[model samples]
Target: MKNVVITGTSRGIGFELAKMFAKNDCRVLALSRNTKPLDDFNHKNITTISVDLSLAEDIKKAVSFVNSNWKKVDILVNNAGKLINKPFTELTSEDFLEVYKINVFAVAELTKNLIPFLQKESHVVTVSSMGGIQGSMKFPGLAAYSSAKGAVITLSELLAEEYKEQQIAFNVLALGAVQTEMLEEAFPGYKAPLSATEMADYIYNFALTGNKFYNGKVLQVSSSTP
Candidate 1:
């Protein structure tokens, strides 16, 4: 079975993705700030690690766990994210740093620590937002979140090129409005057209087959305009 390490598995897309991976017989190393919810899975293939991606120091435990338990990783999904819905004028510099800490820096740090453990044909997929992609529909009150996601997209492109010699693939999934708690928090009562389960299914398949044909590509996924 392929060994997979996924972050933000406590809920929403990350939770669904973990279940899908474990159901498919992949050994999953799930990391989250609060892992109590992960106990509901009770799947033998799933192992939960509690770590707050926003804190750089907390990421060490995740790296150590992976290093001690798994020699190689077939897939690494940087799916954990934090959203701060505040207008640019009201947003503080700390707001930007907090969002980037989770959405961008954590991904970079985790990937750096696990690069050696990535299998030769490993797939690395980072979740981003449509608002981050240039030319995509933009949303109000998402300055910090959008900018951090934009950074993630660019980081993936660079990593894909830098690690091409290792035959490792890196890609970003620029998702549209998915029906998750994060979306609801950002939009209040707005109902999104997509569901977390739906996105998880798409990501699972993409992690397995997408790298064969695409690298350093940002895929815009959504049914709506945004």
Candidate 2:
């Protein structure tokens, strides 16, 4: 069975993705700051780690788990994100850093630490945002969130190139409006065209097989203009 690592699994897409992988007979290590939700689910094939990606110690916990248990990771999904909605003028440096700490820095740190565990044909999929695309429609209060997402997209592209010889694929999914809590936080009352489970289904399939057809690419997984 494929060993999968997914971040931000407390709810929404991450949560659903964890269940999907486990149900499909894949071993999943689910990471989240609050592990209670996943702990309650208690699937035999799923393991939950309490990780606050902003902290180095917390990240080490995840790395330690992988080293101790699953020596190789077949798929790593950097699905954890942080979003702060405030006018650009009112946004402070701390605000930007907080968002980047979780959205950008954490992703890099986790992936870098896990590289040794990822073998040939391993897939690293990062969940980004449509707002990260340069020409995409921009929202009023997502300066920090959108910019951090864009940064990760570039990071994934660079990693894909750096690791191509090893046959590891890195790709970014710039998602559109998904009915996630994060989306609701960014755009209250806005109804998304897709549900978190629907999006998770797509991501689950891609993580298992997208590397064969694509790498170092950002796929825009959006049907609506947001």
Candidate 3:
């Protein structure tokens, strides 16, 4: 069995990923701000750690807890992110900072802390938005969100190169309009081509076996043409 660590397991794609991995008998460490939703699962293999990723201290504590209990991490999914839909003109520096804190900084901080525990041939996948991709379809109100996700892609690429000798694969999944609360919040009254469960299935399989085929790649997943 693999030891999988996933962030943002409170709801949306993260929640589904946790369920999928747990059902597959993976020892799952789920990080989220509120863990009450996960209580309904009641799976012994799934452990929920409640912490605000935006805070460095909280991330340090979470890393300490994981390191104390787990000897090796087979997979780490940096899926915790927030979507703030604000026009470029109205977006404040604080707004950008807030989004980047969760979308980029938190992922970097957590990944850096857990690198020592990652299995030599492990997989690290970060969830980024299609908007993060250069020349992808752009929306009016997602400037901050898109820019932050773009940073995630860059981080994944750089880490992949830096850790190439370690044989740890780093990849970014640039998702497009997954049917989650974040999508609904970003585009009200519009339906997404993919559902959260569908995304979770793809991510689970990718985390399990994708490293064998892909390294330092950004996979754009969508049913519609970008």
Candidate 4:
């Protein structure tokens, strides 16, 4: 069975992604800050780990946990991220650094730490946002978050090119608003965001499709009219 490592598995898209992969008979290693109840689900193919990705030591522990046991990770989903919706001026320097630490630094470091263990033809999907692509007129009060995502996309592009010889795939899921707790907190009364499971389904398909034709690209998925 293919081995997949998914971060942010406590809830939202990450939770659903873990479930779907396990159901499809893949060996799933899920990481989150708090996964106390993960044992309750109790699937033999699933291993849930609780490690706060924002903390550098926690990130090291998580990567080492997977690397020691899983010989080759067939898929890696960098799904854990945070957003600070406060205005640019309102955000302290620490706030901006914390945001990047959780959203971008963690993802990049975790991937860097584990790339040696990734399979030759593996898929690496970084969950980003449309806010990462461009400035949003649909809303305001997220200058840092938007800019971080944009940086993530650029990183994905460079990694995609750098790893082309190995046939390893890298893709970014530029997500539109979704109905996660984060979204509810970021934009109250936001209309028509995709459900967590719906987004998970889209991501699951992309990861499982190892047809060699799909690699190093960004797939935009959403329920918005735009």
Winning candidate number (TM-score): 2
Instruction: Compose the digit string of candidate 1's lDDT tens values, residues 117-144.
Output: 9877899999998889887778888999
**Every candidate's lDDT:** 0.91, 0.96, 0.91, 0.82
lDDT by residue (tens digit), candidate 2, 66-185: 999989999999999999999999999999999999999999999999999999999999999999998999999999999999999999999999999999999999999999999989
Please give, for residues 1-226, the per-residue lDDT of candidate 3 as tens digits: 8999999999999999999999998999999998888878889889988889988888887778777888789999999998789878999999999999999999999999889987677999999988999988888999999999999999999999999999999999999878888988898888888889999999999999999999999999877632
Give the alpha carbon lDDT tens digit for every residue of 1-226 in model 4.
9999999888899988998999999999888887865567788889987888878788788677776887688999999887888876798888788889878888888889888887678989999888776654445777778778788888888888999888888888888878888787778777545789988998899887832666667767765732
TM-scores, all models, native as reference: 0.97, 0.99, 0.97, 0.93
Q: How much is the lDDT of residue 196 in candidate 4? A: 91
Model 4 ranges off by over 4 Å: 135-138
Enumerate residue pairs that collide in model 2: none
Worst 10 residues of 4 by lDDT: 131-140
Clashing pairs in 4: none
